[model samples]
Target: MSSAPVETVLVAGATGGTGRAVMRLAQSRVDTLRVLTRSSDAAADLRAAGADEVIVADLLNPEGLSAAVEGVDAVLSAVGTAPTAIPSGPPFVDGAGNRALVAAAADAGVDAFVMESAVGVGPEPSSPLATAFDAFIGPLQEAKAAAEAAIRDAPLRHTILRPGVLTNGSRTDLVTVADPGAKLWGVISRADVARLMLAAPTTPAAHNRTFEVVSKPRFPARNVSIDWTLP
Candidate 1:
C-alpha cells in the first residue's frame, strides 16, 4: 500500500523552546523539514535534531524571508523576542516580523500557516496571569494582535494558537482548546504546543481558527473532555 503523502514544513524561530519541539516532532511526520534561524550556531544541532535544511534568515529582515518560506507546503512560526528585551522586542519581531512572514507565505503559495501566539493578546485577558503579563508586555501583546489580524487577512489557510503560560512540564496529550474569547488559562508544556502545531495542518477543526489553549489540569472541570478539538 502507498504511504500517506508527507508535507514539507518550514519552521521559523527553530531555536526557541517551542520551535525546537516542533522541529523534533516534524522529523518523523514531514517529508522535508526546514528550519529558519538568524544564526548558524545552531545549524549543526538542528540538523542533528532532524531539520532537512537550515536557512539563515532574520524576521527583521524581510528580504531574506522569501527564501526561507520558499517551496514549503506549510509554515509554522514560533518567533518572538524576549519580553524584557528592548529594541528587538514586540514591535519588530512579533508585529512587523510576523506580518512579513504571513505575506511571504501567501506569496509563496504555502497551503497553511500556523502561529504560536500567547493568551491575553486579543481584546481582553482571560486570566489574572494574562492580565499581569500584559501589564509588562503590553506592546508585545499589541504586536501579536496585529500579527493575528494580518494572518486573518491573508489569503492562505491559517491557525493561530494562543497558549497560556508555558512551562517545562511533560506533555499531557490532553489539551483544552476554545475560541479566542473563551476563558482558557493555565501553563502548558512547550512539547504539547508543538504537537498541536504539528496536527494543525491536517486537523479540519483548526482551519481558519484562532483558539486559546491550556492543559487538562488547568481546564475547567465542567468543560473537560477527551474529545475536545480545536475550533
Candidate 2:
C-alpha cells in the first residue's frame, strides 16, 4: 500500500513536552502544522516553534475538538495528565479526552491517528519493569488502556506507541519497537517518542499497529526493519 503524505498534522496536547518536540520536528517536513492547546497563552510560543496554526480548544470538549480536527491529514495525540493531578485526572484527560479526539478524527475522515500511550497499559505488562511502573500508576494505566481501546475500535488507521519510562535525555536514534506481548522495557527521551509520532503516518509498518518503544545503546549492527506482523 502507498503511504500518504503528511501535509497537515493537527497535534493535540501541543503544549506538553512530547507535543513540543513533535511540532519542532514537523515544521521542516510538513507543509502545514496545527496544534490544539487549551491556553491561548501558548499560541505565540507554539507558532514560534514552527506551528503554522494553533487552535485554543480543550480536549475534554467534544464540540470544540470537532472544529480543531478540520482540514488535517492526520492527528497526533500526546495528551495525558500527571498521575498526582486531580480533576484533570487520568479518567478525564487520558481516557475521555483521547476518546473524543478519536471520534472527531473519524468524523473528519483523517488519514491516520497516532497516539502516545504508556508501556504497562494492556491486560498485563510484558516486562518486569513495566509491571513495576504499572503498580506506581494504577488508575493512570487503566485510563491509557481505555484510550487505546477507543483508538483500536475507531475507523481511522491508527498507530499507538507505548513508550517505557520517559526521560529528559537527548535522542539516541537507536529505538526498538516491540510487539504487544514482547518483553521490552527501558527509558526513552520524549524527543525520540515525538520522532516516532511524526514518522508513524508515513511508515507502512506503523499503520493500525500498537508497539512498545525504548532507546538502547548503540549496537554493533543496526536492525531498523520493523516486524509489522509480530505477535
The per-model lDDT (C-alpha) reads: 0.81, 0.82
Q: Give the number of the best model, judged by TM-score.
A: 2
lDDT by residue (tens digit), candidate 1, 3-112: 11337899988989999988878898778999998887889988998899999887887898888888888889998878767554445688888999999999998888
Per-residue alpha-carbon lDDT of model 2 for 1-231, expressed as tens digits? 557777889999888889988888888888889999989988998888888988888877667887788888889999988867744454467888899899989998888999999888898547887798688877777888998999999998899998888887786667887777666777889988988998888888788988888885322232246633211
lDDT of 1 at 168: 71
Cα RMSDs, all models = 3.6, 3.6
Candidate 1 local distance difference test against the native: 0.81
lDDT of 1 at 34: 96
lDDT of candidate model 2 versus the reference: 0.82
How far does residue 66 in candidate 1 sit from its true spot (Å)? 1.6
Error of 1 at 160 (Å): 0.5
